[model samples]
Target: MKWFEIALVVLTLGSGLVLLLDKLFLAKRRATKGGLLDSEEPALVDYSRAFFPVLAVVLVLRSFIAEPYKIPSSSMMPNLLIGDFILVNKFAYGIRLPITNTKVIPTGEPRRGDVVVFQFPGHPDMPGDPQRGENFIKRVIGLPGDRIGFHGDTLSINGQPLAYEVKGEYVGKGRGAEMNGATLLSEALPGRTHTVLEYLGRANPAGQGDWQVPQGQYLVMGDNRDNSDDGRFWGFLPEQNLRGKAFLIWLNCSGWFCKDGFEPSRIGSGIQ
Candidate 1:
């Protein structure tokens, strides 16, 4: 969560400042002619010393190495189900500062067919925007400057249609049962092939169109074609909004409480 990251950074920095201040001035006052003060160390200083290292390590790992995120919707279904806890490679794209999301190092760029998490481009900075700063995951369909088009449940990139092999109807379970009857097909993209769900005879007028992707942007869509609110509904995803590439499913459990919905088979599977 954004708030979680912010709070972690604040706590780590605050504790570090306290430690620095103590080492510079407070520690001298605590020392006496007998080599130590009669009173014990302040509770605040003790807490700062105890928690600073743990907080600092967590902040560095979560912000630069990898971060865990839970699936909250069925948009990327069949591949990423609701309740799946995935680990996103924070440095997969680049090294970005926490909270500000400013890129400090150029590591790599997203390839077509990569499952990426990004900030929702729903006017996130505008006040009163409910979806502000929200994270959304989808598959990259078109790279910058690529000619992308979608019509009749088919995707075309650079004037060539992506090959699709029907894999039959998808029988979803748990919270994804509603998508059970959706048509399943294995779509072949460059460097990878993944399954996609399409509803025959269903129309998505707003999402069906052709466009030329601009530079520093990407065209993305969900595997659940008919149901996803993705680049088709919005526009090209800004490069600055890119969070990271989701590569693994670490855990999966349905519902708010950890009740009877655990999909063990999906655990440790890499996202294709």
Candidate 2:
């Protein structure tokens, strides 16, 4: 469910609880004080007094402030791994209404190298499907009007090759065990620097179709180059599908078992 929808559900339940408490406690107090014993009247007053305000606050905060999302895929490995709970700054891009996702305030636009979480535009019916509406976290490699290409596994943005230096081999985890042979590298993108993984012997698919990013859109790719299914296969993420910028890794667990314990190094780490 969309964050706004979830907020609405919570608001509804909280309001209901408050109303029930008022009827059970406040109504009895008034009755003891010699007030008119109108049962239906109390229900009306209780609902109006308790529910609307609380729901309004929740709607404003969640729609314009921040929202939490969990990483459920390895598409952004090394930067964001499976089981990583992250906080997305909703207002980082702009302020939008909850359910309708209509932007109400203009905050700012996404920049190159920002790690963003967006709803996949690929099959609309499968919204939130792990493989469909699946929230994808990736770096904005190419902006509107930018020309991007890949040569021998190297990324060339607007005809300029990005700087890359091999660091070492990545030690895979859980389902990532099969990618243990992937090489880890420190790639410098514009003003930001982050680690990326590349599988050995996998030649960059050259002569691939080029894309001219349209207005109000961006091209994103995973840090784990070969492993991610990004703009190369799917397509550019529309500005409206953007959820927010992932700024922090609040928690990281090895897997569902959480047996590996907290990763101290990854704690409080800022997303690129």
In order, the Cα lDDT scores of the candidates are 0.90, 0.77
- List clash counts for every candidate, in order: 0, 1
User: In candidate 1, residue 183 scores what lDDT?
Assistant: 94
Give one digit per residue, the lDDT tens place, for model 2 in 101-207. 67879899999899998877784444565665546788898888888876676777777788989888888655455568789988888777888888756855732
Highest TM-score model number: 1
For model 2, give the 10-residue run with minimal summed lDDT.
123-132
TM-score of 1: 0.95
Per residue, candidate 1 scores C-alpha lDDT tens digits across 1-272 of 88998999999999999999989988876674334542467878889999999999999999999999999999998888998999999999999999999999999999999999998878433557678578999999999999998999789999999899999989977777879989998999878899988897786887799989999999999999998988887778999999999999999998767574788888999998
Residue 73 CA displacement from its true place in model 2, Å: 0.7
Residue 216, model 1: Cα distance from true site in angstroms: 0.5
